[model samples]
Target: MLLEAHSLSFSYGNTPALSDLTVSLPNGATGLLGPNGAGKTTFVRIIMGLLRIPKGKLRVHGREVATESKALKAVIGLVPEGEILVPDITAVQYTAYAGRISGLSSTEAMDRAHMVLHYVGLGGDRYRKIDGYSKGMRQRLKLAQALVHDPKLLILDEPTDGMDPKARDEMLDLLKELGNDHGKDLLLCTHLLDDVRRVCRRVLVLSQGRKMGLVDIEMQGKDTDLYAVTMRGPIPPFIDFLESHGFKVDVDTDGEGQIALSRGAADQFIQHAVSQSVQIRRLVPLRESLEEVFTRLVSKDT
Candidate 1:
């Protein structure tokens, strides 16, 4: 586990912000998903050592969060939920400053600043005053500064917040690049279910300061991949047969008889259909969408 929280709890005065929460994030992208006030920001603050943990155990990179705070801080990158930059500073200078503040040598800081500026889509514009940049550009600047330190893990709080559709897509593209091309681990903190589904490989959902669910994002089931099979024979009885035998069948029309659902048991569904003497042409199980998962989790929480 790259990040772990065991029974972590925290409070604001008498009000609890995190309640007995326990979760572990691995090397790839993981989502901290929930609506606003669900403790996502508080959780990130705790791991970053900005918020004091009055109770529970928290660790990052195998170092205790409270006692080994310095060690954890050195390895983790944080794109805070709020803007923390001087508007008059240029991207290159501010990013270099960030690296130096993280204890990098002056030479290393300059090199990293240049590299991250290009990485985040700020080229010639990198020399422009940050105040002139757009919302998306500012968000990218925050991400670039965080990466200036070359931390192994990146924690982003609503990285796409307040962006137009184009900017949001661009941000998502950059996030995918960081995770896939650069191999940077990510803890994506946001309530945006679409972002979680598109970018993260695992998700932990929180609600009302409590954990609602955690799920492994299975792109394909190990033994069996789900497929949607569309055939042109006896739709009603076929669907009935599937459902009657403990299978979940969904009907659809793409100029076919009916749409049937099959899991890793593709072979079984095929055999059953053959035994029933139904002609088959197309079978496809639309991969479960992230939206489906988020809806299920949030609904259950309420």
Candidate 2:
């Protein structure tokens, strides 16, 4: 398991932040999803060892969080939502500083800083002061600093926040490469569902400081029985036939000559369509979008 929390709970004075949360997250890329005040930041802070474990057991990579936080921090990197840069320093200097904080020797830190800055596409501008960089460049620089230590897992908070569309796509592509090709585990915390859909295989949703759902993004809306079908020629009779036979059919509302049906009745549906001289143009299984899944989970929690 990448992370395991058993009966985890936390509070800020009289108010609760996390409420008896229990979850096991596997290795690989996973999205952390939640609405405002949902404890997402609190959870990340706890994992980063900034907050003490107030109650229950929490472990990262099989080590107890309460006892092994220092050791765990050595293997975890963070790309926080807020800026961590010093305006007077160059990107290389800041990145090297981060590496040193992660326990690397000065020589190793400087070398790794140069390598990671290049890897994140900041090599050309690495010597320039951070105050002159654009939002996108700053975001990438944060990523460079996080990668300076080569941590096994990266906890990214709104990594693409404030980026334009092109920059957002580039950042997402980098995340995909790191997770798929570079063998890095990631915890991508963000408000954008599309980001999670694009880069993460799994999602853990929270609501009101509680675990709402854990979803397999690829399998969330797949129903073997449900299929989208398009047909040419007259559609009313085919629709009538399927509806009369007790197979629920939903005609496409956009005038696309498409309908949805249960796959169990597909043979009968197709046979009737053939008998009626209707052409089956397309038939494919339907998958739910991450937005739909997120809405459903949050709604249920409320």
In order, candidate lDDTs are: 0.82, 0.89
Give the residue spans of candidate 2 off by over 4 A. 231-246, 251-279
Per-residue lDDT of 201-265 in model 1, one digit per residue for the tens?
A: 88888877788877777642332344556676666787778878877666654325333343456
Could you give the C-alpha RMSD of every candidate to the true structure, in order shown? 3.3, 2.8
Provide the lowest-lDDT 10-residue window in model 2: 252-261
Question: What TM-score goes with each of the models?
Answer: 0.85, 0.87
Residue pair clashes in candidate 2: none
lDDT of 1: 0.82
Model 2 per-residue lDDT tens digits across residues 1-302: 89999999999998899999999999999999999999999999999889998898899999988888999998999999998887799999999999999999999999999999999999999999999999899999999989999999999999999899998998999999999998899999999989998999999999988999999987776764666777777777767776787876776533244345654667777888888888877777777678888898999987
Model 2, residue 298: distance off in Å is 0.9
